[model samples]
Target: MSLTSEERAYIRSQSLARLATIGPNGPQVRPVGFVLNDDDTLDIGGPKLRESQKYRNARAHAEVALVIDDMAPADDPIAAGWGRGVEIRGRAELLTLDAPPMAPDFFSNDVIRVHPSRVISWHIAPEGQARDIV
Candidate 1:
């Protein structure tokens, strides 16, 4: 599996992630809404996505990184670790849907699809074990 059951659950529980891309000047990072598909791919769609610099960057340079993460609330006395996260290093491609976008609430049909080549997870598994897939 591209992601373990626990990892999938962690991803589904979150609503935001940081998408990093290479721009003309340097690396650009932004908060983005994403959809994780059954095929283990990530779809990032937004209004006017095609006009954004990120889209242009992905089209020109496919390499990218996405990070979804959170820290335990201070009140959660029994929570594991100081943080939990997943980092995906992958190749991204520009794409469009036929009608509705993957995230229909406030996104458009234009999207960037990320096919993960390597995954790094920390503080997600029980016993706080970290793993890497490359």
Candidate 2:
């Protein structure tokens, strides 16, 4: 299913996200700390991080995919059986300077901003399919 405004907003509000990029070797995955900008751009910050392979890969390819989800089980086991998740497809761009200030401990390096092209939401069904709920 497609994403609703609320689901997209929830995905942006998340603090932790998994970024997927195309590296010289192959596809690379990393857990990143990010902030959602008012303009719908995702700001990722880290020290020395800007020079990392992920950064280089993004610069070369630009295309990226991100996933954010709540992993904790709900108070009710039945409710917990259903999983909630958000996925974003977008192009990543390197932010050189004048970026917003993040917490000192937020990300140790430079920031990579991702502008989403598509957003989708998912839930675990009783039959166990990761069904798109939105």
Q: Pick the candidate with the highest TM-score.
A: 1
Error of 1 at 3 (Å): 1.0
Candidate 2 local lDDT, 16-100, one digit each (tens): 7889999988999998777776676777766677778889999999999888877536663433645567777888988765543
Candidate 1: TM-score?
0.90
- Give the Cα error of residue 21 in candidate 2, in Å: 0.2
C-alpha lDDT score of every prediction, in listed order: 0.86, 0.71
Error of 2 at 114 (Å): 0.7
Residue 37 lDDT (model 1): 84
Give the Å error, residue 55, model 1: 0.4
Q: What's model 1's overall lDDT?
A: 0.86
